[model samples]
Target chain A: MTGPLGALRASAVLAIAALATLLQVSLAPHLAWRGVGPDLALLVVVAAGLAWGAHSGLLLGFGAGVVLDLVPPADHLVGRWALALMVVGYVAGRVRADLRPDRRPALGTIVATAAACSFVGTSVFALSGLVLGDATTGVGGLLGVILASVVWDVALAVLLVPVLLRALARLEPEHAR
Target chain B: MTVLDLRPRSPEPPERPGRPGPGGRDDARRPREGRRRPVRLPRPATGRGWGDDREPTPPRSLVVALVLAAASLMALDAAGALAPVRGAVAAVAGPAESAVSAVARPLTAAPDWVRSQGALRDDVARLRSENDALRGRLAAAPYASNRLREYDGLSRLTGRLGYAVVPAHVVGIGPAQSFADTVTLDAGSAAGLRPDLTVVNAQGLVGRVLSVTRSTATVLLVTDADSVVGGRVGTTMDVGTLRGRGEVGPHGLLDLELVDRDATPARDDAVVTWGSQGRGPYVAGVPIGRVTKVVSSVRETAQRAEIEPYVDFGALDLVGVVVPDGTRGDRGVIEADGTLVPGEAR
Candidate 1:
């Protein structure tokens, strides 16, 4: 599915995804509010999806999700996040596809997509865990995760997405870009 | 036809005033009736093809295949079929994580280090002079009785309580992802650290070992909402069940529900762990916390109170895990005199 140039881009995307996951898992607690931190890995996947399109998004999200699943203290079914993040990537890609970047308000689009991703990703995870009888969070806890995550991601996207888009654009072949 | 084509076309017709621009705004001209009106123009075509420059959506089959793959992996992991795979991954990731934590720890403590640098130097200079004076005193005192007395007291205490203890350092804390109250210890199964081993620090009980890997083990903090420890009041010796209240504010608090209905534990009463059945999970006589507030009950049989834990869950560094020896026979309960005794005799 990937050519030589495409593979390079994918590798770069994957590296960023892994670093984001590590930061989220390790350092984010120090900056948490009420026991919730922004999901940096989710932001990276969403950005990749929007900038590179659905295929790139799906692949990045899946790989990042798998890495998160394998990380210690995960203590849940592997690939649970993989499934949720994949959906987030696809939806973000579709939104980007519908409204060409040149025609849309850049910051508004990024914020909206990030907010949607956080909400959808968290809801899917909580609901699936509940169905599988593995989740301990109640409705209030689920709500807190969604609310806190969306607020944090949107704030971060305003600064992060534009920079990420520039980097991603450099990775794309000149002709394709 | 050639003569007509050779003739120059009449000068291009002059454009009318007030013609609108490409942006749909027009030049304004005064009407004959004295009212000004702006004329609007139709938009010119850019000639770019719609959706031609855009990347096409990925094939539906690709998405479905990926989803199926993810679902299958999830199912396998949930069924515990992927334990070996998970373990292999952890074995690699755990050490890398620990190394990262080791580097990050200093950075986090940078402020404290900076603050103490000046004081530390002064203290070192002062201690050097004091050491010289102390050496003189030591030389003059041929028989130092303080050291011998201290060792005698230590030996007596250890002899009274037969506890196999292994000291370990706290390596890392709960990640931000789950916000769980847990700590990773440097020692694991290699050091005889099995799951359910009781861990404590200098102050009081820390928590129990939840899981152990080859090189590290994760301890579940007593401050975790899921943790429950059997506790007793210091003065009244009233037994109660102690539970973590999660992070209520700056730190975590414990709630105690006394088993004895008539026992009213007062403020400042020390709480200690009621011994585990076989010295598993928790050991007897470990200080848990001090009572801050006592809530009286009229309708209910049990009394409740809030406990401020002795150990600071936020700043744990070094800890000790009590490893039990099976030969100790049946574990004893804490007597009113604060001594361990056979439960039957009590």
Candidate 2:
């Protein structure tokens, strides 16, 4: 996975990440349910980890998180998303590598993994924000935000994860054959 | 199709030692080219955990190193060293965000359109708006003469103040990406906007420009929890601090803490901004909101109240950025009774 094809695949991942960050900043705000929107960027990173292995997940997560941090109107600390997503990707890849290594993941498995990762990523972000200071949400509000983020991510995972898996799979068809 | 085994399948046929089975797909077989590794990866040792192409341990160290880098970035950003770096990123990402926001603007309005799509309510709403506009016209008819008499004062006032406004629109509002309340404006440094400039809608004070890129600016709304503005009660003239509660609508409120120990703040009292020192961030005498509820501190002498903002942040559209015009030097302040107070605001 380290040749020209690999480079092409990595760029494709970055493009998807850029698109996710764009939508998260522009369109997601309007789609927000009860002041909580779906975390498209985070979900995409989870998909990367699940589709690729742990190394790919870690790299893509950091890159995507930076875009999210710098998107217009973003006010959180620059590296908060990067850290949260990096951890999320590593864990997601491990889930695929361990537990159910050889077989393709079912839709139910994908959704469950996404929900779990969403919870972990959001909690890490919130906790880090509190530690770093400048966080606005109190403990009670942070809990509500996390719950909402999980729900939104799971609902979207039903559609997004499978599509992402297929796309990533296409990048390595030569190896697969 | 073989690559994606989405459906449940039975286990593959067990392979013999020296030679692989006919399919040889799931087994530890190298690629035909021999230069490339198999996509599904050479299967790990017996009793190894699931389907990944590579071992997972390397990623563990990568995660730790990246996390440390993130922590250092947070520290640098907190200490205010990342402004230029952030600006550079925004310079690249701002236009894309603005373009997408503009393109998807109708999508944002789609919810309301769908809600109003019912034929009966659509007609009713349209007629109501038309009726309101006509009624507004008729009501203004009686004030025509009054408006004419005030025109002289308005012209003089404009001439004296001389600070013109640059019109802009809100391009985006945040959700999960940002924890605080912020919006992206369609205008930025090219429009002569800088940080600390006041943003206002026709209703009242909206926010202040927090950061500016070449073509876009981010405004920190008055409804963010970290936001604090100097405010005063209209009737009592008791100066106090008004803080945003990080929400919108009836539930989201601005907290007003009065400075005077004995100041009695009442419900329905009007609140306005007490201008910043240099007439930036906030200008004097802009309507902010009305007090919805008042709660006096039992322990502390300072009284508190809740304010419902006049501007509907959810539906913000057109806005004005107050930029000081620095031509025709020494334009004095406009006070009542045709008196000029010499613009000494610094």
Best by DockQ: 2
Chain B TM (all candidates): 0.48, 0.48
Clashing pairs in 2: A101-B50, A101-B51, A102-B51
Model 2 DockQ class: acceptable
Residue range with the least summed lDDT across 10 consecutive positions in model 1 chain A = A96-105
Q: What is every candidate's C-alpha DockQ against the true complex, given to 2 decimals?
A: 0.13, 0.24
Q: Evaluate model 1: give its lDDT.
A: 0.72
Candidate 1, which segments miss by more than 4 Å at Cα? A3-5, A101-105, A175-177, B1-55, B102-346
lDDT of 2 at A149: 93
Report the C-alpha lDDT of model 2 over B14-67, residue by residue, as the tens digit: 234457645565453543443243244334334323234645544345667788
Specify the highest-TM-score model's number.
2
iRMS for all predictions? 7.4, 5.0
| Candidate 1 docking classification | incorrect
Clashes of each: 0, 3
